[model samples]
Target: MCTAAEWDDFRATGTRRPVNFDADGFVHLSTRDQVHLPANRLFGGREDVVLLHLDPARLGAEIRWEPGVPTDPDSMLFPHLYGLLPADAVVAVTPYLPGPDGLFGTPPLP
Candidate 1:
């Protein structure tokens, strides 16, 4: 997920990637069951974000399973994309603004 402003910048550039992706050589993605926790942990109280529903088949990057934060259990692995995410890979874009008080709850998923 990314902020609304960040999305706008991505549209202009045709590529979407966070600073961490450049620093770490991969873009981070969380699973449906995992996103809420990380969202709260990393973006608590932030209301300007957007949820990007991606289609892995549309991805132009190389994705690899990698260990999550070293603090987590050693067996945990997450998908890391080795290149910028092209807009085409994003099948849907929904506003992820938090509700009042700037807190997020589990989002409805399909």
Candidate 2:
């Protein structure tokens, strides 16, 4: 997920390198079923958050499935892209607002 401003920048540039990409060496991605996990952890209570729905085949980069943070379920794996995220790869973009409790739940399906 990214902030609304970040999404606008991504559209203008046609690509995006997440803030942590340099340190992590890959762009973090979460499946539809698991997006809420990280959204809540990192962006909870933030109304500006937006979810970028991507088409995997259009990514034009190598994707690796790796274990998530320690707090996640033991068997869960997340997708990481080794290159910048091209804007064309995003099939949809949706606001990811947190609930009144200040926590994110599963986002609406694209």
Candidate 3:
């Protein structure tokens, strides 16, 4: 539930760091690329539980968010990495899975 003002605040921080949540629920700042790759693969393809904060503008690109049925495990390909994203952050979503032939085709923004 991130509000526009809250998003503004985050951006105003003048930092492009990845926020980390520890096992104790404590949050800290880290580099965006510091996020582990395995975590990124975890959420490669998902349908249920709309993930917020997938900003195309931030990505400086256009993409599409095609919702698919949630698969088993209910986890993202790179859960740890993708989970670090802000709950309300907007991303350029593409309905594609990882591995060979990733992201089938280019996703155009709406």
- As a whole number from 0 to 100, the lDDT of residue 83 in candidate 2 is 95
**C-alpha lDDT of all candidate models, in order:** 0.79, 0.93, 0.31
* Rank by TM-score (best first): 2, 1, 3
RMSD of model 3, in Å?
12.7
Model 2 lDDT per residue over 1-110, tens place: 89999999999999999888899999999998899999988987999999999999999999999999999999999999999999999998999998999999888886
Q: Which prediction has the highest TM-score against the true structure?
A: 2
Error of 2 at 101 (Å): 0.5
How many backbone clashes are present in model 1? 0
Clashes of each: 0, 0, 21
Candidate 1 local lDDT, 12-83, one digit each (tens): 898887878768998888776566656776788898878888899888879998888866568877888888
Supply the global lDDT for candidate 2: 0.93
Ranking by lDDT: 2, 1, 3
Model 3 over residues 2-109: C-alpha lDDT tens digits? 223444555576322343345423222112232223223343333221112344334332233222225423433211232333433444222323334332222223
lDDT of prediction 3:
0.31
Residue 42 C-alpha lDDT in model 2: 91
